[model samples]
Target chain A: MLQTDSLKFSYPKGQTFGFPNIGCKAEETLLILGNSGTGKTTFLNLIALLLRPSSGELIINNTQTASLSEKQITEFRAQNIGIVFQKPYFVNALNVSENLLLANYLGNNALDKGKAAELANSLGFEHLLSKKVQELSGGEQQRVCIARALMNTPKVILADEPTSALDDENCEKVADLLEKQSKIIGAALIVVTHDHRLKSRFNNQITL
Target chain B: MLIKIVWKNIWAKKLNSFLCILLMMFGISIISLLINIGNQMQDKFSKNISGIDMVVGAKGSPLQLILSGVYQIDAPTGNIPMSELQSLQTNPLVKQVLPLSMGDNYQGFRIVGTTYPYLKHFEADYAVGVVFKNNMEVVLGATVARKLNLKLNESFASSHGFEKEGEAHGDKKYKVVGILKSNNSVIDNLILCDLKSIWEIHEHEEEHANETPEKHTEHANEATEEDFDITCALVKFRSPMGLMTIPRLINQNTKMQAALPAIEINRLFELMGIGIDAFKALALAIMLISGISVFVTLYNALKERKYEMALMLSMGGKRTKLFFILMFEGLFLSLSGYILGVLLSRIGLWIASRMLDQNFNFDLQQSMLQKEEIYLLIAALLVGIFAAVIPSLGIYRINISKTLAND
Candidate 1:
């Protein structure tokens, strides 16, 4: 399970973000909706442990995150959490399969090519495994991004603007895949986006 | 996995990496070639100049006199009378006077007519038979015997001049009596005989045809004072007083000119140093430019890959790890360039040795790697590090969250 209490962040000479407290159980899904300038990305970053929060009690698997050192936080994040960014970015020098393997590498997990091939096969991009990521279409890239996030099989999966750039059909397929994959891994799935179509699909929801 | 990524990243930009390596190779190759030839020339010159204090030849360029008399690589200044050296033989300042008369060749090797003192001067030992005793008999240098396949008791006619195609002095053939051991000196390239032999050959060539066998035998024993002429003479001073007084005295007082071997060789090196210094500067500039190219390539790559770097960082990759990845790229490029450059220099030296062997009858032998090139390797490494480290430091400053959020 993942939970946050009194989460607050302040950018220097910029607006301070005050996030609402929320909790999501493993194998469950939570959707966060916000328009531009609503600190949706900021909230995701704090939960991702990418940026230090001004003040907060952030917990994942009953470990208090605020007391963790920077190095420990990076280790904890790598081992326990998987993040999918809205825009599909990759180390373009690498192929699609290598991109997935990069997650296992950075997370300090064993290099498991079988797991990468399985993720690609399940996400319906097995044929495109050796191809460069830039060659993939928008929907294919989104699915690949999801596959990359699932490589380490962490306890929590956080995706920001996961379906903002997708059409109606791809949006439904992506949302179904995200939920099914996260449920299969038994991770607390968190989706942060301004995509309104996702609201009716997810039972638990938050608006900033 | 890290190595695979580094390879992929470097291969992604082929032209940039190739140009950087090319620049480094060019820089290293030139310096290596110069070092090889410079060292070989210095070695040959010093070995040949080892016991001689002064060279007295007919009035001409001092450098030419040193080259002709000491190294035996240039044409003689013209002949001086053997009587001119007689006074020096008696002078207390002089230790030894070795007269040299060279006006002919056997094939491409010059026939140097001198006394036993010249062999003693170079410490040349008899590998076979004995030293030349008869006027027309010759003793071959070690290389001359090896190259020409001439052996003891072998008779070969001399050519009229320095070239192999010069008119043959077929009537008076030189009989090889002895062959010298490998001495690694200028003496190794000559055919040694007495000074009287050179005089008789030229005098016979001048008044040729219809000479009876009786007159041939008579001319050998009838060499007078006027017939005594030598190309030049190498002088050794018994004391430092000879060096202080002789060169100036001979240069000012007589038709003969004295050249100090040490001074002339040093002046030759100084003149050569100008061209060498210019080329060295140019090579160093190319290396600097290569370093700059590496800097610009990585700097631009960092700017363009900030998103990828930040994304990797968010995935828990350490900045130092990424920093070393870029460093490895630099290391590979420069090191490969260095290896190829050293190989190129060896090939260049081989070609140079071939050309010198053909033209001057001198071959340059050098070791695989010189002392300076080891230092060059270190220099190349420093360039690689400085070029890579500056740009890779940018990996640390990447704001992971902001970069991922914006892009």
Candidate 2:
């Protein structure tokens, strides 16, 4: 489970943001819909522990993250948080399988090649595991990104604008994959995007 | 995994990495070559001049005396009366003395009229036949024998001067009776003959000149056994008293000047050190520039890969791990360059030794690694780490949210 309470953040230039309290249980999906400059990515970054909230309480798997040290937060984030970003960014130098293994490496876990292959098979990109990221098509790259995020089986999966650049078919397929993968891992799935097509796909919704 | 990532990153920027490696290789090769050549040459020079305490020759440049009498690399200043050297040899403070009679060459190898003691001093042994036992018989040094392709019983006419192409001593030829083993010393380049042969050759030249009345000088009739002369005499002292009194006594009382090999060699090194030091500074400057290029390459790469860095950071990679990835790139480039540089320097030394052997009969093929080179490697690593750390510090400043959100 992932929960946030009255999350607030401010940039050095004096722009402050106050977000509504949000909560999601394991195997649930939350859709955050917002237009440009809605601080949707900032909210995801805070829950990812990438950006420390100025004033907030972030609880993931029943552990409060606000008071954790920097190192502890980084470790905790690596072990329990999975992020799928927009545009399907993978390390250009690594093959598809190595990209997934990188997630395990960063999470301080022994590389599970079997888990990577299984995820690749489930995501329908097992044949593309040895190929470079640039060799993959748009849909294949999205599927690899989903597999990479699910590598550590984190308690919360956050995605930023994951379907904004895809076609209607690929976007729905990606949304379904993200939900299906998170449900299989029993993790809370949170997606932030400006795409209005995802609003009906998710029952729990927030608009900014 | 980190190493693999670093390798891939370097391969991805192949051109930039190659440029850095080339620059480093150039700098390191220059420094290593300088050190190797300088060390080998100094070692050879010191080894060749070790036993002789003082060189007594005609009053002239002391450096020329040491270079000619001990190292046999320079022309003799002039000849001193053999009677004068004989008296010095008998002095109580003098343990031994070896007279050197130069002024003739057989195919560019100097013919030194010295005794068995000189050969023993260098620990030379005959590789073929036996040592010269007669006035016309000769024993060739290893290099001379090999280069001239001379064998026992082969005869070659001596040239009148130090140069290879000088006027020939037409009436007489010296037969090679022996060839010396390679001893890696000055003796390896000499043509050894009896002192009587040098005197006989000069006497015959004087007699021939006397036949032409117009060219005859008063000294034509002065050639005799008692009045014979030698170019220089190498002196070794029996004790410290000889070192204190012998050279000064010779300088003050005799027409000949005494040159201490140690002092003259030191002066020669001091003069040559200026050039070596300048070259060393030039090598160091090139290394510094290479280091700066590494810094620029990595710094630009970090700037260009800001988004990638942010993505790695968001994947829960520590900033320090990303920093090390860049550091490893720099270390890998410098280490490869250093290894190649060392090998190239050894190749350079081998080529130099071959050329020197062909021309000067000096061997410089000692390809052993020096302690200074280990220090150089450490310095290179420090330079690599320092150059990399400056730019990789940007990892700490990367705002993952801003970078990811903006991209």
Candidate 3:
């Protein structure tokens, strides 16, 4: 579960962002929509604990993240939260399967190759395990990004513009996959996007 | 797993990695080869000149006299009659006089006619058979015996001079009576015989003199001793008194000239040291540039992989962990280059050894590991770390949220 109350952040005299309080439980999906230049990325970063809130109560799995030390914050974030980037980037030297296992390795969790393969199988890219990341198509690469985020089985999964580059067909498939996987792992899923297509699919929604 | 990443990342930039390794290898091999050749030549030079104090020969270049008389590598400076060196040979300060006559050669190995004391000078022991008890009996040096495959009781006639085209002294043959152990000196390449054999061989050039071979005691006569000619006499003094006055006395009062072996060889080494020192400096410069290239390769890689760094950072990979992984790349490259360079140097040494063996009767011992080689390896590793340290620090500055958001 993840909860945030009156989260506020400022970028060194550049801009201040005052966000709404949010509460999402296990087996839940929250869709936050915002227009361009509306601090969508900043909000995602604040929730990722990459940037410490100026003032807020941000909690994940019932632990207060605002009070955690820098080292503790990194460890806590890695163990409890997973984020899918707006655009996918990978360790180009690694193959598709190793990219997935990287998350577990970086999280200080035991590498589970079986879990990676199972994720690939469910996401319809099992045969592409040995293939290089650059060899995959746009849709395939996006699915891989999704699969990687679930490697450590975090309690909170954050998706940033997950379907911004996909067509009508891949956009729905990736959304359904994310929702289904989060339900299986019993995690609160948060996806921030400007796409109208996903606005209707998600009933629990907020706008920035 | 971390090591694999380091290795893979290095290979990912193929041209950069290849260039880096090639530079370091060239630098290392050049230094290694210089060290091997320098050590071997110095050891051989000092070993050959150890006990000898002076070389007295007919008038010529002192360097040539030392080269021919002590190292047996050059032509002797004309022949001196044995009578001229008689006074110096009997002086109170004179310990021993080794009369070396180099005229005849079997195949290409010089037949140095000297006494048994010459072998004692070099500590050359008999490997097989006994010392020659009669004239015209010869003891082959270890390398000469092994290379020419001459065995005990085999007889071979000498050629007139060192060249294969030199006329043969086919009238009489010298029997191989013994072979000496290898002492890694000039003697290892020579064939030793009694001085009487040289005189008899030269005197009988016109008269069919093998028929008068029973006159072996001719050396005992004063007339024959006065008439005999020797290329040079290697002299050892009992004290420093002889070195000061004997060479000056011989050069001024007599027709023969005296040269100190130590001074001549030392002059030669100092001249050659200039070229060697320059080559070593060039090699070191190349090594420094190679280290810089490694730095550039890693730095560019870090710049290009900013996104990947941020992604891994966001996944909770410690900056220090990523830093160590990248640092290992430089270490691996340096170490691999060092291994290859040493192997190349050995190959070069082997080729040189073969050439020296053929031309100068010299062999370089190859199996010995040089202390400089070990030190260079450690230097290579330090260079590796020094090169990687700056670029790997870029890991800590990556802003995971900003980088990922911008991407």
Candidate 4:
């Protein structure tokens, strides 16, 4: 379970606060809705323990992230967090399988090939694992990133505009994959986006 | 996996990698060739001077004496009296002596006039003909014969002193009776004849003569004992007595000075050693600068790739792992450059040795990878790490939340 109390973050060069106060919890889907400049992505970053708050406390799985040292924060993020970026970033030189393997390297976990293959086949990414990220279309790359995010089966999933680049059909496919996979793994899902089309898929909503 | 990524990154930017490697190759090639040449020169000098224990010659700069008498280059210091040479030769500790008189030149090659003992001292082998037996007969080195295209029984006139156009001793044409085999020594560049021939050629000139005037002209045709004052006498002792006794006897009794070839040559190398070490330091400095360039480039790249780094960080990558990725990139460039540089150096030495063989008859072999070179490579790799350390530290400072928000 994750929660935040009066979480405040600001861009070092900006004049306004990112979000006055923000919070989230597990066992619920938090849909953060805001326009392009409304700090929706910043709020999700705070919940995911990717960014430290300028002033406030962030509790993830009951551990206060603000009070932890940098080393502890890194370990905490590795064991408890997973993130999907809007643009679907990946090491272009690495194939999809290697990208997935990287998650294990970061977590220092023994890779379970059978589990990974099962997950890849279920997500329609099994055939794409040996291909480079650059060789994939936007939808395929996003699916790879989503697969990479789920590689370690973390307790929480934070997606930053997971379906922005896809059309209606691919968007539905990606949204379904993210929602069904997160629920199946018992991870709390947080999607930061201004797209109104994805709002109907989530049960909870938090407007920035 | 980290190294593999680094290697692929470098391969992707093949042009940049090759440019850096070429710069390293150019530097290494020149340095290796110079080092190999220096090694060969030292070996040649040592090998040629091995038979002689000491050089007893006129009082002057010891280096000049060694260069003229042992290396067959430069001018003789001066001539000492035959009686003075004889006194040193008759010492109870003396073994065998070979006296050399050098004043003439055959087309820029030294024409050294000495006895058959001088030929035996070098262990001279005939590649085409036998050793000179008559007064006007001459033995040519392999280089001299090759350059002049002179064959057996061919004759050429000697020139006065060392000048190319100086007064020609045209009346004294010497027949080339022998062609010596390639020796890779200073002897390979000299023309040798009996000492009597030198005295006979300069009999009319007393300033050129050091022996008694009455006796000098008297032995003009016969090469009498007093016709020549010894230009330099190479003394070898029967035992190690010459190492201790010959120098003292020559210094105490005669106007001549006896110089040990090994000591003088070692001192020469020491003098040259300082400049060589400074050059090596300069080379190291250049390699350091190149390594820093590689580090700074990669580090700056890491900084620019912060968003990508943070994305990985958020995906569960440890900060230490990302830091090592950047560091590995630096090491990859250095190791590749070092190997390319060593290869370039070997090729350079091979080409240079081939070119020099035409004149020096030296088939110089470049020494293989030295332990010192390995140290240099390791130092280069460490320098790459050192250069990247500041940049890699940026990974720790990358705020993941801020990075993702910006993205």
Candidate 5:
């Protein structure tokens, strides 16, 4: 579970981002919708613990995330969070398997090669695991990124415009993969997107 | 995983990586070549004069005596009185005295006249014919024999000076009595003969006949007499006695000056030492600059990859892990550059040594990669780290919320 009580964040001196209070529960699919200047991405970042809230208590899994030291915050994030990005940035030189291996390494977890392979195969990435990240198509790269995100079996999945670049068919495919994977792992699935077509797929929605 | 990422990143910009490595290789090769040649030159020059304790010559330049007597590459200073040489030979401190006379050249090499003692002093066991015995008999250095293609018993006339075309000692042909083995010394460029042969050829030269014809005639006809003059005398002490006493006696009592081969060579190295140090400093600077380039490039890449970094951060990659990831990239680049540089340098040295031997007849032996090269490699790696430190800070600054929001 993630809780942000009276969360206030701004880019600089006068630019405000997150609202004063926002929270999302575990195992729920969140649809955060907002106009360009509102703090939709900022709220997701705050919830992900990547940025310090200007003022408030931000908690995840019963721990006050905002109160944790930088090192502790890093450890907490590694153990509890997963992220998928819109453009699907990857370490281009590495093959899909190697990229996933790094996620496990950064998480301070022993590589469960069998589990990683299983995840890849179930997500239809089995043959693509040996290919370099740059060689994969956009949809394939996004799936690999998703596989990377779930490698450590974290409790929260925060996706930022995860399907923005994909075609309608591929977008649904990616959303299906994210929703199914999050449910199987028993983690919160927070999907941020401008596309209203995904509203029906999520069980929960947060309007900014 | 860190290594894999770094490698992929590098391969992504293959041309840039290749360019950087090529530049490093070029720098390394030049340094290696210069260092190796300098080493070989010092080795060959020192070996050329190894056995001679002191070089006694006419009262003029000591360097000239060393160049002509020990190396046989320059004009003799002048001849000394035979009586003076005889008196020095009679000294109880004198172990062996090999008199040298120079003034002629076969092809472009100096023809040196000395006794069998000179060959023994250099440990020159003839590779092909017997040692010099009769008048006008010449022993060829390994290089000289190979170059002119003159085998044993083949006769070649001597030139007056080092030039190929000059006043020739055409009247007195010197038969090649022996050919020496490759010694990697100045001796490899010389033609050796009896001291009397040099005296005999120059005794009646046109230039000498114009000024000192009577003096030449006096020495030529008075061969039966105990009077003679040699260009220089190579002296080895019987014990430490000559080392302590002979130089002092020669400097004070005689007109000739005795030069210690080791001391003069040491002085020469001291003079050249500054240049070598300067070259080393330049090499250090290049390595430092290359390291900085690596750091700056990676750091810049990190800034551009901020969103990606934040994505990783939110994916549960720790700040410390991210930090190490950047640092390891730098380490990988520097180490690869250094290794490549070393290989290039070694090859360059081999090529340079070959060229030197071919052109100068100065044999430069191929040496192993030196220990200092390792230090250079370490320096490069450290520089790489220094460059990466500032940029890796991006990982800590990446705002996961903003990055994910913007995405």
Candidate 6:
């Protein structure tokens, strides 16, 4: 489970935000819909522990993360939370298989080639395992990004505008794939995006 | 995995990394080359002049006298009368005096007329035959025997002057009696003979010239004055008192001048030091420029890859690991540059030694690396670390939310 309580943040000489409380349980999906400049990316960053909220309480797997040190927070985030960003960004220097392996490496776990190949097989990109990420098509790269986020089987998965750039067909296919993968891994899935097409896909939805 | 990331990153920016390496190599090669040459030259000079304390010769440049009498690489000032050196030979402050009579050459190798004490000073053992005991017999040094392809009992006429194309003393042929083993000293390039042989050769030339019609009377008056003149005398003092007093006594009171080998060699080094120091400064400047190039390359790369770095951080990679990735890139370039520079310098020195052997008959082959080069490697690595550290500090300030939000 992942939960946040009255998350507030402010940038110097800029906007201040007082976000609503949100929670997601295992095998559940939550969609946060907002237009531009609604702080959707900032909310995803705070959930991923990439940004420290000024006044908030973040609980992942029943552990309060606000009190943890910076190093502990990094370790906790790596082992328990997965992040899938927009535009399917992969390290250009690494091949598809190495890119998957990088997730395990960053999470401080032993490399699991078997797990990587299994995820690739399920996502239907196992044949492109040895190929560079740059050579993949748009749909293929998004599927690879979903597989990488599931590498460590985290307790929570947070995605930022994952379907904004895809067409109607790929956007739905990507949303279905992300929800299916999260359910299979028994993780709480939360996606923050400005796309209106995803609003009907999730029953638990919020608009900012 | 960290290593793999570091290697991949370096390969991704191959051109910039190679430029940094090339610059470092230029600086390192110059430093290694100069150090090798300086050390070898110092070794050769010190080893060759260890026993000789002073050189007594006709009054002129003392440095020229030491160069000719001690190193055998320069021309003598003039010949001093043998009668004038008698006092130095029997003086209480002098331990031993070895007289040198030069003015002849055989195929560019100097022929020196000296006693067995000169060979003993360098510990030169005969390679094949015995030492020369007769006036017209000669003992060839190892280099001369191998270069000229001369054998024992073979006779060769000496040229009248030091030049290779000088007039040959055809009437007096000196037979090779011995060949010495290589001892890495001045003796390795000389042909040794008795002092009487050079004197007799000059006397014979004078007599043959007197038989000519026009100059017979003019040369006859000079015959009595030219008795047994020698080029110089190598003197070793019995005590420190000789060093304090003998050189000044000879310079002020006698026609002969005393030149200390230690003093002249120091003067030569002081003159060469100006050039070496300038070259060293140039090398250091190149090294600093290379370091700056590395800094600029890495800093710009960090700016361009900020999103990638943020992506890695969001994937749970530690900020320290990202910092090490850039640091390892700098270290990799510097390490490879240093290794290549050392190899290039050694090959350069080998080629230089071969050329000197073929032309000047001086051996300068040193295959071992110097201890100072280890310090140089450390310094190069420190430069690499210093260059990488400033840019790597950017890792601490990367606002992951801002960077990813912008992307």
lDDT by residue (tens digit), candidate 4, B312-388: 78766778888888778776677777778788878877887787655434556778876556665777677767877
Tens-place lDDT per residue, model 1, A28-59, is 99998889888999999999999889998999
Locate the minimum summed-lDDT window of 10 residues in model 4 chain B: B215-224
Model 6 DockQ, alpha carbons vs. true complex: 0.67
Candidate with the larger TM-score of 1 and 5: 1
Model 5's alpha-carbon lDDT is 0.77
Candidate 5 docking quality: incorrect, acceptable, medium or high: acceptable
- CAPRI quality band, candidate 1: high
Better of 5 and 6 by DockQ: 6
- The residue ranges of model 4 lying beyond 4 angstroms of the native Cα positions read A1-28, A35-39, A53-69, A111-120, A125-130, B43-68, B72-97, B101-232, B235-289, B370-375
Comparing chain B with the reference, what is the TM-score for each candidate?
0.93, 0.93, 0.94, 0.80, 0.85, 0.92
lDDT of 2 by residue, B1-407 (tens): 99989988888788988988887887888899999888888988999988889999999999999998998888899999888987887788898998889999987889999877888888889899887789988888898898899988999899988888999998899999999999878988999988889988987887776666643443456656447888998988999889998899899999999999999999999999999999988988887887888899999988888888888888889999999898888899888888888888888888988998777767787677798899889978887888888998889899888888774
lDDT of 3 by residue, B1-407 (tens): 67767876887888999998998999899999999999889999999999999999999999999999999989889999888878987899999999999988998999988888998899988999887778899999999999999999999999998876699998889999999998788888999999888877877773454435444344335355766789999999999999989999999998999999999998999999999999999998888888999999999999899999988889888888999988998888888888888999999999999998788777898956798888989988888889988999889888888888884
- Highest DockQ: give the candidate number: 1
Q: Each model's TM-score?
A: 0.95, 0.89, 0.95, 0.70, 0.76, 0.91
Q: How far does residue B221 in candidate 2 sit from its true spot (Å)?
A: 7.1
After superposing the true interface residues, what Cα RMSD does each candidate give?
Answer: 0.7, 1.0, 0.9, 1.9, 2.2, 1.1
Kindly list the per-residue Cα lDDT of model 1 for residues B113-207, writing each as its tens digit: 99998999899899998988878989998989998999899899999889999999988989999999987899889999998888878777756
Worst 10 residues of 1 chain B by lDDT: B218-227
- How does each model score on lDDT? 0.91, 0.88, 0.90, 0.77, 0.77, 0.88
Model 5, range B1-407, lDDT digits (tens) per residue?
66666677778767666655555555565566567767766877788777789999888778777877776656778888667878878888888888877767877777888888787778886789988888889999898898889899899888887677877776778898899997666667889998777776776564455666676555656463246677888898888878988898898888889988888777777878888778867776666666666766787678767766776776567777778888877777776777787777777766776776555555556577766566666666666678677888777777666555554
Report the number of backbone clashes for model 4. 1
